[model samples]
Target: MEEVIENPDRIEIEVTDVTNVIKPFKFTKDTSKSSLTILNQSIENIDIHEIWNNTTLHICADGGANRLYEYGGDKRSEFIPDFIVGDLDSITDEVKDYYKKQGTKIIPQLSQYASDFMKSMSLILLYFNGVEIVDVDEYDGLSKLMNQLNDKHLVNINSYILNGLGGRFDQSIHSINQIHILNQQYPTLKNVFINEQDIVFMIPKGRNLIGYNSISDFYKGNKFPVIGLLPFSPCIISSWGLKWDVRNWKSSMNGKVSSSNGIVSTNGVIIECDEDLVVNIER
Candidate 1:
């Protein structure tokens, strides 16, 4: 008997086209606030300098160090991550050495159960809270660290800019899971996952204004940016304030997916939803 392997290229193409339908509301760059930037697999269209200067901390999740090292040059001083964390598997020895020499804290978590992305997230929590990374005996100890950070009233995360999604399917979904988990656990933390052509994030359950100063805030000077209001989770959702607005529309994997919707309004857009949903903006 022969085993059949599914072609990932086909799946990626399908999702890319499916996700590109929504038209986005844009905003100008502030260039002053803080952001934690993650260099994952795909980081082509991002303005590394803009994100680096505005963000207060930098973190690389495991092999993400490689992407950072490759994409970042003498600009290393500008975007040096405050901490590099992961299971220590995919990260190359050369990349590790380079960051170590630069005085970046390397946390070797030898747990196969937890993914590198999750470990990186844990480190971000610690850094934002101003807590020291105490050595732990097992990866399960991550729960303890979270508890300690919470008990000490030290979890102070505001917003984060994540790079590299739209590459590997599982990793991309994992990133989406982090968005929901972080929002549920730490409502104070705002997460925006950046890819080569788009930025993906979640809208909390309620009203949200997808506002922007000018369309150029995202596209330099192109036409209106693409946007989508997606219902990727298992929940059924109802939404308002869209060009093709839905009234009590039931959304789920087994139901309709709002993948190719567009934004027709000119002065920003608004979306009111009964449940939390995923939103993507074309870069």
Candidate 2:
């Protein structure tokens, strides 16, 4: 059965760990829901304010806190992350104390087993649940809070927006992995990763119409955002909508792949496929 609930405050999406899954999505003004901006080490200072203004939640991963603290300077108050989380390895004492004094919660999850990115995600989930952080060092305390909320079915999540992608090749790939992992593991959370230029999201399997006010809405008339029908998984796939649109195009890491494709139509674009695929829009 399909379920739809009224949540004017957020957008919910499901993603998978497999690469090259093409699900359909439409970029509309109404689709602009709550944002979750993640600042990694690769982030730049120029767009910090813009991202901060557009997002409802701000998060800094391990070293991301240091970047924010340094780049945020006098404008630091304007872009304070609601929560600063990680293993506390790269986070400096001065940065931690500074944000804490500014009323930001510093969560230190020393579990080397889990990635700092994963811990940050847990904090985001907690924030959406409206749970105050009285302690960060209790044994499995955050996990216990999550479990209790799950038991009572009181977990509420907003659309998550991420920044700082396409920098380090491995970390960028890891970010994409989280995209698929969250979709499969926590199918209720909505996510978007914003890079230095474009916005990235997943399209689930089936027919999807990507409507926009204009192609220029995302790109500024230079050209349609660069798109790709990436097949990172073992499964072969095909795609449509490109200067060289494919018909029954079987794609995989080892087979024919679509990359560096541009939007040609003036009105909008349409992408249809049997599996989920990743879409990139150059900003």
Candidate 3:
């Protein structure tokens, strides 16, 4: 995809509203849709209050239950997870008992082939599809049921994962790989990886309008949001409405890349690429 202008040579542009990061709890543009997944790591500065209140479904990935358990402090009682899905390894006895007693479904998926993050995603899909989480098998139950359904019939899920990236080198790479895999196999599953600094996601092939309404509407800060366009695989790219928008440019890890780019458009930015790109925008 190239331009917004109607031309037989260009691919039609798609609009992705990313206003939920700032206004997740409040209804905006006549809709409120998002899901929260907590990975096993430190979530020291994440806005647990806002995200917990806004997201439609919440799940903790094994040890992540412990992070959520401590982050909530006195408010732990108020923000109970809907389900805890993993290999039953990292979650402590105390934290496990806490959420289980709170009526949260504890699904033990003992599959070394799939990471707990993948298990969490499949669990969310099964949950929204109305599958009984407890009744499924433990070894690879989530994937089993998820494969039975067609992609067209699966629900579109906007997932925000806390502590997903910036962990140990291998796990972080696995998280990145999972992002790309989701785009290839489950295109409807829009997943974002978040820490204290970055809101990371995959920008697919063709044109993508990134942002909702105006920048001021969501962010009232003085600085423009810093962003990057990273190509895991070499690709040709073009763009509009960025501080340094490229045209017919080649982006690759071995060649030119777009990093430390700032969003300048008040409305939104347009990105066109021949291949999928990993994007990380400052929140």
Q: Give the whole-model CA lDDT for all candidates, comma-separated.
A: 0.62, 0.60, 0.76
Error of 3 at 71 (Å): 0.5
Sorting all predicted structures by lDDT, with the top scorer first, yields: 3, 1, 2
**How many clashes in each candidate?**
8, 10, 1
- What digit string (tens of lDDT, one per residue) describes model 1 on residues 64-177? 788788777667655577777777777799988888888898877778776777766666676567666667644555545777666655443445555646677887787788
Tens-digit lDDT string for candidate 3 (167-215):
6898888899888998888776788777788678887888776755656
TM-score of structure candidate 3 = 0.87
Query: Candidate 2 — worst ten consecutive residues by lDDT sum?
Result: 2-11
What is the C-alpha lDDT profile of model 2 across 1-283, one tens digit per residue? 2121222211222222333332222222222334455655656534645446655677788778888877877877777777777777788889888889989877777777667777777676666667766676733456656664464443434444446465678877887777777766665555666666667766555555554545546666554567766655644343334555555556677876677777664444455557666667666
**Per-model root-mean-square deviation over C-alphas:** 9.8, 8.3, 5.7
Better of 1 and 2 by TM-score: 1
- Residue 215's lDDT in candidate 3: 60
Candidate 1 colliding pairs: 22-226, 22-227, 22-228, 23-226, 23-227, 24-226, 26-212, 35-55
Q: Report the error of model 2 at residue 225, Å.
A: 2.0
Residue 177 alpha-carbon offset, candidate 2, angstroms: 1.6
- For model 2, what is the error of residue 181's alpha carbon versus the real structure, in angstroms, after optimal superposition? 1.2
